[model samples]
Target: MTKTVLVTGGNRGIGLAIAKGLIANDRRVIIGARDLASGMEAAETIGAEAVELDVSDRQSIQRCAEYIGPVDILVNNAGVLYDRRVLQNPGDFDVSMATMVHGPFYLIQQFEDHMRKNNFGRIVNMSSEWGSFSEGLLGPNAYGIAKAALNAMTKALSAQLPNNVKINSACPGWVRTGMGGFTAPRSPEEGADTPIWLATLPDDGPTGGFFRDREPLGW
Candidate 1:
């Protein structure tokens, strides 16, 4: 049977790239966008299903869980990077945590049981090198802190989840997405490479690990 994959923040950039790639691989792909209209447009254009999902909102996550059907793979690619650090915009920290850390946990809670029942699942948490303590948590406005928490979440849940239910964190590197900007050397497709790989990991694949370019990354 074909697997279904959900890619959050799939209206643009790396998320969109992952969605498109998964569809090309014969997976039933669903793209989640914060705006319903935008999501529908992108889905129609790309041949993937669309859902209105603002991961920061628990109600939105709940609604999606009700309507999106069973998802075999989940790509938690939704995130925001604040231009200013906490000193300039403390609110950025909250938004960062809500979108990247808390939201993903809520999503896992909603989906993990279904995944377990089916005895197969894959979860890809989009993280960053900045999330690594080894790298000094360098992202601005709690971006690194949020991703670090996300990475920690991956590790914590992995310990208890069934062996077939794999979860891992991926860093897309300096890609030229809207967030990464045009000056970045890598393209969105390049950024998506590792995330897509993680999303499609085999039953025996490594779990609760950090990776970039499909190689292990230090926590």
Candidate 2:
């Protein structure tokens, strides 16, 4: 049976690459985007389905979860970068946390019980080295802070989930996405590699860990 995989922010960039790779691998893929038209366009191009999901909105996240029911896997890839004035503007920090931290948290809560009942599931949080204390939480504004919270959640949630269910954080290095800019050294496909790997891990695969390029990374 084919597993169903939903990737947030999958209309473009590394998320799109991950969705395409999953489709190619015989998984039932769904691309989530803030814009329905673009999401559908990307889904049609990639032979997958599309769902409207604005990770920054609580209502949107809840509605999206209801609309998509149970997914075998989830890729929490949606994110945004606020201006350098995060401290100067409270809304920037709020939006950052709402999108990256709270949104994924609610999505996971909505589906984790289903996964536990099925005794099989995989969750990949599209985290970054910026979230790492080792990396100095270096991402500008609240980006790193939000992702660090995400990484912490991944570990916390993993403890509550069953053995067959796996949840891990992945840092897709600077890829040539809009966020990564044109001069980035990596391609979206290259960035998607480790994420796709984590999404399809065997039962014995590591859980509650941070990784990049399929190797362990410190948080």
Off by over 4 Å in 1: none
Deviation (Å) of 121 in candidate 2 = 0.7
> Compared to the true structure, candidate 1 yields what TM-score?
0.97
Whole-model lDDT per candidate: 0.91, 0.92
lDDT of 2 by residue, 1-219 (tens): 779898999999999999999998899999989999999999999899999999888889889889988988999999998757787888888988998999899888878888888889999999999889888888887898899999999999989889788999999999998898999999999999999999999989999999999999988
Q: lDDT tens digits, residues 8-29, model 1?
A: 9998889999999999889999
RMSD of 2: 0.9
In model 2, the worst 10-residue window by lDDT is 81-90
- Ten residues in sequence with the least summed lDDT for candidate 1: 81-90
RMSD of each: 1.0, 0.9
Clash pairs, model 2 backbone: none
